[model samples]
Target: MCDGYATHNGELAIGRNLKVAFMPWKGYNFEDAIILSERVVREDLFTSLHIAEHVVSVRETKRGSEELTADIPNISENATKDLDENGMIRVGAHAKTGDILIGKITPKGESDPTPEEKLLRAILEKAGDVKDASLKQNHLTKVL
Candidate 1:
């Protein structure tokens, strides 16, 4: 029995397409992305090949009697946090279907302060100019 599985060499953004001469899976020559696009759809590999700064958009293909349009979908990035000045992935970074394209890392001061940090800052401000006073959480007080 023939195995119904194929490995993709590279991944394309869901809405993007790369013109190719031939595709191994289709066993034919075409002017659009072949196996990569199928993998994107079959495997449901949405966004980011392996990391941030990359995404996979579902490709769109339509064939008409006189016209053929194959529009690839746009890649969706997984990272939603604020990026540091130098924390973005470099341009022209090549990644395979299962490789890392962009690695996201928030810098120490780039991301918004956590709720604890904000609360601490507020408490510190409230306690400002008071030498012997410190803020403490009171479990006995119930928020209405």
Candidate 2:
């Protein structure tokens, strides 16, 4: 019966058998505290990978529709280095925490423009009434 059960389960191993000692170390392991060796961390023997996914959606708003574009205003060039021309992170890009994964802009409401803004708008022939709504990474991960 044991052989049949083992054969059905395919002999799955879930845990590693490590050499354990029951001695206290530096007065820290007094009450069931476990002390791990430096090799465990250096080799990453128990490290696990966690994957998190984030989605950015552009929806219509009362002011106007949100847009996804690479031309985000008031952002530094270094922040958008991983982003492609289509405002999306390139595949295989390493995204760090607080890095913009998707560049997005939302239109602002119609309000009185400042004199300097009016002059620049007239000279540039563009409406600079958009606020950045880009999606940012909350943790370090790789774009796949």
Candidate 3:
């Protein structure tokens, strides 16, 4: 049985079928890799990401046609609901390497500060006190 605890930067929704395993990280110890691909893909650590674990076929029901499973650790009976009472994504579904999923918790928009803008602002604001402007610029350039 899977421990159901997967160490991923991404969240695993309630009913999604994911191939969870301990995959190699930097060296000796393995990190819990909750991924879509059952097999290891080349250079998977950095490039090539998946958004969903499986293609959920829609049906007449608002909840869709995907079957919920109990294998996932903390999944509840109502895991297949399109959204919970609070309007968050239903818990059980998850994204994996090859699946075409939908809905992101963090929608893409101009809602937050851009990294470049923030970095540039930080440099300009702080560099005023520094003697060497070129050196600070160099450091920022490297960061960018």
Q: Model 1 over residues 30-144: C-alpha lDDT tens digits?
A: 5545344566667775654432222432222221011111111122233211212333223443323432222221112345556776578678853212111111222222111
Displacement of residue 85 (Cα, Å) in model 3 is 1.0
The 0-to-1 C-alpha lDDT of every candidate, in the order given, reads 0.32, 0.81, 0.33
| Number of the top TM-score candidate | 2
Q: List, residue by residue over 17-118, the lDDT tens digit for candidate 2.
A: 687566656667566555678898799998777866777889987655788888899999999988889899999999899999999999795775678876
User: For residues 1-144, what per-residue lDDT tens digits would candidate 3 score against the true structure?
Assistant: 334456334555344344555666766565645455534455353343333233333233221122222222233334323333332334454423322122212112234445775477568852111111010111111110
Task: Give lDDT: candidate 2, residue 7.
Answer: 53
Query: Which ranking of candidates, highest lDDT first?
Result: 2, 3, 1
- Model 1 TM-score on a 0 to 1 scale: 0.16
Q: Candidate 1 regions off by >4 Å?
A: 1-87, 104-116, 119-144
Ranking by TM-score: 2, 1, 3
- Give Cα distance to truth, residue 78, candidate 1, Å: 19
